[model samples]
Target: MWIHKSRNPNQNFKRGGCMFSIFLWEEKDVQRGLFKMTCFSAVEPKQLGVILKDMQRIKDGYAWFLDGCVFCIQPFQNQSRYSLKGYRIFFNTSIETGMYLYDITLGLLGGQISGIECVIKCPSKKSSDWISGLRSDTSFQMTDPRGLFNKNGCGIIVVNDTVILQMRNRNKLKVYEALKKIDSIREELLSSVEYDLFSCSKEAG
Candidate 1:
C-alpha cells in the first residue's frame, strides 16, 4: 500500500472503470505529491541502469529475475504484411514480491513499455473454469482497447494452471488501486475454496 495525498484538492478520484492515462511525475512533483505527464522515448542503457538502481533501493527482500523476452507482432488488415511491435521482457517473482514489483516496473518503464500483463499461478484451481466464470459474470466486464482479452470478453486469460491479468493503466496510483481491487476480487472468488495447506507449507519451507 503506497498512499499519497493528491496535490489538487478539487480532483475527485472515482472508483471503477479502466480509463486511466499515463502519469509521469518528476522527483520534485513526487515530493509535492502531484501527478505529471511523460513522453514516449527510446530506452537507453544508462536509463536502464538508473531503473536497476531505483529497483535496488526499494526491492527490500523481493527479487525480479529476468525470465525471457517475447517478440510482439502486429498484422496488417487485408494485406500480407506484419509489423514488429517491440519486445516484451518477462520476469519471474514470487506472488508476494510481484504485487509491488508490478507497480514499480510499470512506473519506471511505462513511458517505453506499452502494456504489462501479470500471470498469476493458480495451481489449486482449474484456471479455465475460473476464467469462464469471471467472463460470464457481469461484474468483471472490463473494456480493453488493446484486444488482449480472450474470446470470453474480459481482461483475463486462462493458460493451464495460470491466470493472466492484463493491466493497461499506466498511472502508478491507479495501478495500486487496481491491484487492491484485484486482491479483493480474488478473495471473494476463492472464499469458498479450501486452503491449500500443502502449498502453504511448501512455500514456508
Candidate 2:
C-alpha cells in the first residue's frame, strides 16, 4: 500500500497510516538465555524437575518454563549451509497459554495457534540453536520424512529418529496467570504544525 503526498514533491512518497500497524506483527526473537527480557514470551517446558523443584530447564542454550508435557530437542542440521539446532514437542493436550517458538513441530497431543515459523541460531551455553512458536491445539501438519502424510502437514528438521521428546503439562490458570504480566507496548508519532488540521482550520478562518 503506497501513499502519495506531493506537489512536484520530494520523490512523491509518504507513508500511510496503516504502515505503522505493521510493526505490531513484526517477529521478535525471545531467546531463553536473555531471561529478564520480554515478559511476553511463552513456553510450556516438559521438564517437571525445573518447575516443581523451582529449577530452570535449559534447552538449546536457554531457560524455559516447565509445567508438564513431553517434548524433544535436537540440533537442527538439514540444509547444506547452516548447522542449527532445534527441538520438537509432542503435546498430549494444550493449556493454550500462547507459546512462542522459532518453529514448532507437533505430534498427536497438541499444536500451535499462530507461531513463529522460522528457526533461530542460538549461541549459548545450554543448547545450540533454539526454535519457538505459539502453542495451540489445532492439529497442524508437521513434516513427515516417510513421505506418507496427508494434506495437513508440518515441516520438521529431523536429524535422527534422535528426536528427544520433552514434557511439563501444568494447570491452565497458572500459565495464563503468569502471562498476564506481559503488557502491550504503545508508541506515539508526531507531525509538523504545517499539517496540523486544527492550525490549518484556524489560519483559513
Candidate 3:
C-alpha cells in the first residue's frame, strides 16, 4: 500500500498529461514533531554514485527503472478540473537480496550486422538513463561477474515494496502495457490514487 507524500503542489512539474511517476515513502521529521514531505529529484548518472552512497530512504522518490525485463512507472498529477493522481505496480515477495539486470538496444541487435558502423547504438538515448541505474545496481550484486551488466544481460528485478515516484519514461508501449496489467482489476488505478493524494494533501496542511 504505497502512499502519497507531496506538499506545496506548485513545485511539481507541469501537468501536461505526459507526466508519470513511481516514488517511495519520503518523510521529513522536524524536531520529532511536525514532519514535512518533499518529493525527491532525479540524480544524473554522474550523481547516481552519490545517491547509492546515501542509505537514506530510497522509496522516498525514485523516477523509474529500465533495463531489459525490469521496469517501473513514475507518478504524476492530473489536470482535469483540478485533480492529482499517480500509479504503482506491486511486485511479489520472491525478489531476493540483489536486483535485476537486462539489456535493451535500439534496433535489432545480437545478430549478423550487414552495416558494421551503421548498426544500432548499444543503448538508445531515451531509456539509457534509467537502464543505466539498473545496470549500476547490478554492479553491487554479491554474485558472479561483478561488472557483467553490459549487453545480452540477465536477471529481471521483479520484486520490491510499493514505491511512489514521478513517471519520467515516455515509452508508450511499455507504460501502457505495464499500467494496464497491474490496474486491470481496478480498471483505473489513478482514480484511487487521486483520492489518496487528495487525502494526503489535506493531512499535510
Candidate 4:
C-alpha cells in the first residue's frame, strides 16, 4: 500500500487549481522501496539534461521525481485542470528492474519541464527546506492540486507516500514509445540502481 506524505502546516502559499501527475512504481512490491514519481506539461528536452547532472540523490536513488508546468494554472480564474487524455496504459513493470529504469527515465524527463518542483524519496516525513520552498513560491499550492492521483481533492502534497501515488488504476501509453527508447539504452546507461531511500530530513537538515 502506498502512503501519502503531508506537508508542514505552518507554511503558506497561493496558486491556481490546474494540476496533474504521472508516476511509475513497482505495483507488485511497495516495500522494496523502488519507484519513480514525475510531473510534466511542456518541457525543453535539451535544458533537462543540464539539470539532471545537479541532482545527486536521484543519481544515487535517494529521491523521488517531481516536475510540473509552472504556468498551467492561474489563481484568478477557475480553469479546468489539464489531463493526460487519450493515453491508457497500466503502470505495471515486468520486473523490479523495469521499475528502476522507469524511475530514472521519469527523473530525466522531469528536468525537461519548466518547474522541476521537488524530489523526495518515499517514507520521508518532513523537511524545513520543503516547508520553506512552499512558502517561498507563490506558484506552488499549499494543498493538493486537482487531476490524476489527486483523488483527495487537495492541491499537490509536498510529502506524498500513500497509495494515491501508486496510480494502480491509471497509466499513460503516450509514454510507451519513450519508455521503449529508454529501455533500449537502459543497460548501457543504467547498469544497476540502488533501491535504498535516504531520509529527506537527514539530508535537508
Candidate 5:
C-alpha cells in the first residue's frame, strides 16, 4: 500500500467552464530521479487508418513521425478472437514531438478526444523515489492510479521503469500547465537529492 501526503485542494483549477483536475500518485518506499515526457491518445478503433494517413500526408519530412511513434488498434473480446477495441496513437522521442501530436490531434478531432495521456519516464532515477518526492512536494491528491482517473480524469502512475502522468481534459492550455507543474516538481526533487548526495560524499571523505 502507498501512503501519500495531501496536496492543496485549491490547486484544482477550472477555466472557461471546462472541467480540469490533476493528481499525483505516491508510494511508501522509493528513490529520486529526472523525467522526460511521452504521450498517446485513445481514439475510435476504426479511425486508426484515417488518422495515420492524414498524419503521413502532413509529416513534412519529420522522420521522427515514422521512426519515433506507433499506431495500433487494440484487440478485444467480443464473441470471437479478432474483435477490435480502440486505437492507441503513441508519440515518444521528445517533448516537441509529443506536443506537435497533441496540437494536430486537437485540430483533427476537436473535442472528440478526451485528452492525451503523458508518460514521464525517469531513466536515470528510481521511480519509487520520484513517487515519494512528488507525494511530498505537490498538493495533488495522493490516490491509486485508478482512483486518480475515475475521479478527476487526470492522475499519475508509477510503473516498473517510469511514472505515467495522465490527463483526460480536452483543454490544451490546462494540459500543458499540468505537465509544467510536474516538470517543476521533478526538477526540485533532482536538485534537493543531488545536493544531499554531494554533502554525504563530502562528509564521508
Candidate 6:
C-alpha cells in the first residue's frame, strides 16, 4: 500500500471541479510515466458535474476515481497497443484523515459500477513482483517481466485486484473511513503475498 500526503492539500488537491483542461504530453518518457501521476488542477464543482453528465452520453470508455496526493507506481507494456485497449476517465476525490492519508479508486463502466483494480511498481525490498495472490474474484490483468528496475531501488511491482470502494460519503468522517478501508485492503494484499522479488533473486544467485 502506497500512501501520499500532500504538503498543502488545498493548493495541490482539486476534486470534481470544472474548467476543462486537457494536458498533452510534450516529452516522450515523461508522457509514458504520466498516468502514474494525477495532474488535474482546481475547477468549479458545477462545471465538473457538467463534464461528467456529458461523459455519460458516450457508450464506451472506463470511469474511475483519482484521489489526489496518492498514487501507485507500476510497469506498463502492451503487446497490442493499437488494438481495442480500454480507455479510462478518472475523477479526483480526496479523503483526508489525521493519522492516515491516501486515495481510493472507484471504477464504472457503461454507466454501471464495476470493480476496482490497481497495478503498481514498488521496490523489490518493499514489495514482491508476484501479484497473483492479490487476485480478487473478478477478472484482472497483470504483466511483470523478469528484469525491470527504476533509478530508485524500488522495483517489486504490486497490484490490488480486490477492494471495491462505496461512493457513500455523508461527511468528512465517512470519507476518512472509506480511505482507511482502501489502504487497509492494500496492506493486506502486500502482506499476504509472502515473498519478495529479491528473495527469489537471492536464491537464484
| Candidate that scores best on lDDT | 5
Please state the error at residue 133 of candidate 3 in Å: 30
Given candidate 6, what's the lDDT at residue 127? Answer: 26
lDDT of 2: 0.22
Give one digit per residue, the lDDT tens place, for model 4 in 1-205: 1122332212222112222222223222232222232344233323334543433221112122232101111111222346321211122233343334434644334322111121122233233333443455454345433212122221234333322222222233233333343333232212211211234345777
Candidate 1 lDDT over residue span 74-146, tens digit each: 1111232243212233333332444345446533554333344444444355655565555666666534422
lDDT per residue (tens digit) for residues 1-205 in model 5: 1112243222332221322222111221123322223223334434545654543321111111233232212212122224323223333323454455656653344423334444444435465665565566456566763213221344666565455555554335365555555545545545766776788799999
TM-score of each: 0.37, 0.18, 0.17, 0.21, 0.42, 0.27
For each of the candidates, the C-alpha root-mean-square deviation to the true structure, in angstroms, is 15.8, 23.3, 21.3, 18.2, 14.2, 14.9
Stronger candidate by TM-score (1 vs 3): 1
In angstroms, the error of model 4 at 99 is 7.1
Give one digit per residue, the lDDT tens place, for model 2 in 1-205: 1122221111111121212110111111211100111111122433323432322233322222333221222222222233222233211112232233212222211322222121211222112111111111123233443321111222323121111111122222232323222110000001211234457689999
C-alpha lDDT of residue 169 in model 5 = 48
By summed lDDT, the worst window of 10 consecutive residues in model 1 runs over 69-78
How should the candidates be ordered by TM-score, best one leading?
A: 5, 1, 6, 4, 2, 3
Winner of 2 and 5 under TM-score: 5
> In model 6, what is the error at residue 196, expressed in angstroms?
2.7
- Per residue, candidate 3 scores C-alpha lDDT tens digits across 145-173 of 32112221212211111111212232222
Q: Report, for every candidate in turn, its global Cα lDDT versus the true structure.
A: 0.36, 0.22, 0.24, 0.28, 0.40, 0.27
Residue 43 alpha-carbon offset, candidate 3, angstroms:
29
**Residue-wise lDDT of candidate 6 within 137-201, one digit each (tens)?**
12233324322222111222332211222222222224334334544444544454434545677
User: What local lDDT does model 5 show for residue 112?
Assistant: 32
RMSD of 5: 14.2
Runs in model 2 deviating more than 4 A are 1-59, 70-95, 98-147, 153-205
TM-score of 2: 0.18
